[model samples]
Target: MNMSPKSFLFLFLFLFSLAFTYGQEGLPRLRISENQRFMITEDCEPFFWMADTAWELFHRCDREEAAFYLKKRAEQGFNVVQAVALAEIDGLQSPNPYGETPLIGLDPRQPNPAYFSHVDKVVEMAAAEGIYIALLPTWGDKVFTHSWGKGPEVFTEENARSFGKWIGNRYKDQSNIIWVIGGDRNPREGTSDVAIWRALAAGIVEGTGGQDKALMTFHPQPAGPGGSSNWFHNDEWLDFNMHQTGHCANQPTYQKISYDYNLQPVKPTLDGEPLYEDHPNCFNAKELGYSLPEDIRRIMYWNVFAGAFGQTYGCHDVWQMYTTDREGINGPLRPWKVALDLPMANQMKHLKNLMLSRPFLTRIPAPEMIPANQEDNTDFVIATRDSEGSYAMVYFPTGQSKAVNCKPLNSRLLKVTWYDPRTGNQIDAGIISKAPSNTFVPPSSGGKGHDWVLILDAV
Candidate 1:
């Protein structure tokens, strides 16, 4: 049967509209909580943004490999995957597994549709797995190329906006998309970096319709004091704040989390990058050695107890999808598939469950409850509580018994328990008297692996 050209055009347009509609309506869009401290779903449900860094997902993995990674992470209770469109490991020069580069002639404004089609497929696959894609439009190298990244330094203030708008439009309808700007590079004051990122953000807002269209944040390179907030915290487009915190052990990262939490203009914050499961601690394998699972577990507890809404877990190997055939970032021990089951990845759910087990929305940082000097201690004791004083948790890094100021808590009778962050087990420690201050000994003590969280549930 012969078909009319007009009929073909009409059919194509109709199918495209259907796809666009599904993209928008398929997942619940995330929004900032009313308290401006956490993420909530479109239906007003608490959303714990447990994410895994898969910076090389689109660059290295084919469709099958990408899906496999998503399935595994979703099962591990990660609701978000932090990935990149233009990856960091020489992404512009090297083609993807499909032999397609993201841009035509390394020009940000002239994105190659063929290359982006793979990115589209990866994001769609993530959505299908009930996962949000925390997408970086381009890695930091593409922007600053400051110290390490290979530079052809392709982005400018003008093209940054154009690229941002185009990429934003392509995924405007995909509900699971969370735009993360500035990649891993921090914008300097004197340079055009800030202007370019702002332009890019403006383009995204334009493409997606408005500032309220999606959740947005920046990923910074462990720049202390404020991290992303050092620059963009006051910006309208930034929905939350994130910090890398680098890959060192005994970092006292809770200090960073608490700093952001108490900023003049409050915005939600979390550790975008913490010490990875097996990264060379301080990037010195010869001396400090690879990070243990305990290193990551402590950092996670430290950040959350200090008032981070959620945590992002990473394994040095898995983020790059390391395989025997490829060169490693920092001496990866296993392939990405094996790295998926690394202790911290599976154990991350325990933190998610612990947070959700409590009264989530009402929680606030209780730094005053912890001894001021302990704030900088490697055996750091940190605390958080229901803003209403309904419940509280204090983490003992190395399980050191410390006197906690109990006067601030309104509860007269408190039921205390020792929560093992490593095992997700809560052991009863009997009722406690609420007074000006109290000393509670942790069930386990004396080293890094002996971490415990003292939980107080008030009647």
Candidate 2:
């Protein structure tokens, strides 16, 4: 690797600073709040999980490329990055950029240190940038070998636990690590898949010192209702629930979030994978076409409004780390480097800021604030408010006019403002008295790309 003297100095200082920061105390460790509805920083501040999907980061990117990706994402305000270790694209046999496969002789017990050293450096680099590695030890195909994945199915129940233990122990002290199991596959009944996954969870808990030492969850393929909760809600190790709304648009993902929210033995829920920016809509490019920025923004707001803790954003090209030299999946519009700055990629921070702008920790779904059957249409509105009735936020998909029931907010006048999701700008919508119902309309409304968020704060 050729470098100027200044570049070498920067790397030295970056490493030195991180070594000091983590040596004293790592990046603020996370924990499920006492309410069990959200995550909190070590100091107990609400954690808004703005994450990006980089499934192939470790598998595809070299050190310099990985650093570039992490810097861009950190600048975009993403605190978590979902990536894999035993990657999905023929990872076990295929060597990483360093010419080292993850396992030696396809043996789970014999992990290749050279490859894992690269993984360690990437994790450390992410830690330096204050980003949590939502690390998956292995993709699901390594366990089940599903229809699409190129897996040789190397893990048995015993080896799965052993591998999980080894990996968990390796990163046990990294404060920015969050163990995410199950890479895009759900367990089938009557098979050992469920037991194998459970054993992996137990192994992580044991290796990481104990259950409290780790914040963990499962990432499943797009499933019907409760996603991860459908399988692991009752499991003691699952700290939260994750759903993949999949590569489709106009999905009422909030309904799925609401289902998980209302489930007994409450656990925080989030859409780990929504429609990627440039993905073939529903995997059918000819008929449905590619996903637009508007399509992904709707899913993000809907998940947050309907009681999700927080959610992740993905780009089809970025997840696969596609370049001109590589084969694009489902017609990638651009290379991963160019896809990094795609319009919606920067727009995601707006939602995160809007949620944190007010008292968001106590917030809950405010469906009563919107009219009945509004969700029946694609251009529907969704609302959420502080559990204390202090503030409310409503997302207007097409910026439509609606009679919002402000009475549910509180018996007081409220200060309202229009939040532009596209630009992160706010326009005052004037104050209104709390009445039986109130009509609020956005400045513009016609079709796709005309979305608005109404912010209501009690004055």
What local lDDT does model 1 show for residue 30? 94
Off by more than 4 A, model 1: 1-25
Off by over 4 Å in 2: 1-25
Q: Candidate 1, residues 62-90: lDDT per residue as tens digits?
A: 99999899999999899999999989988
**CA shift of 331, model 1, Å:** 1.5
Query: Worst lDDT window (10 residues) for model 2?
Result: 371-380
Give the TM-score (vs. native) of candidate 1: 0.92
How far is 204's C-alpha from truth in model 2 (Å)?
0.7
Top candidate when judged by lDDT against the true structure:
2
lDDT of each: 0.89, 0.91
Write down the TM-score of every candidate.
Answer: 0.92, 0.95
CA shift of 444, model 2, Å: 0.6
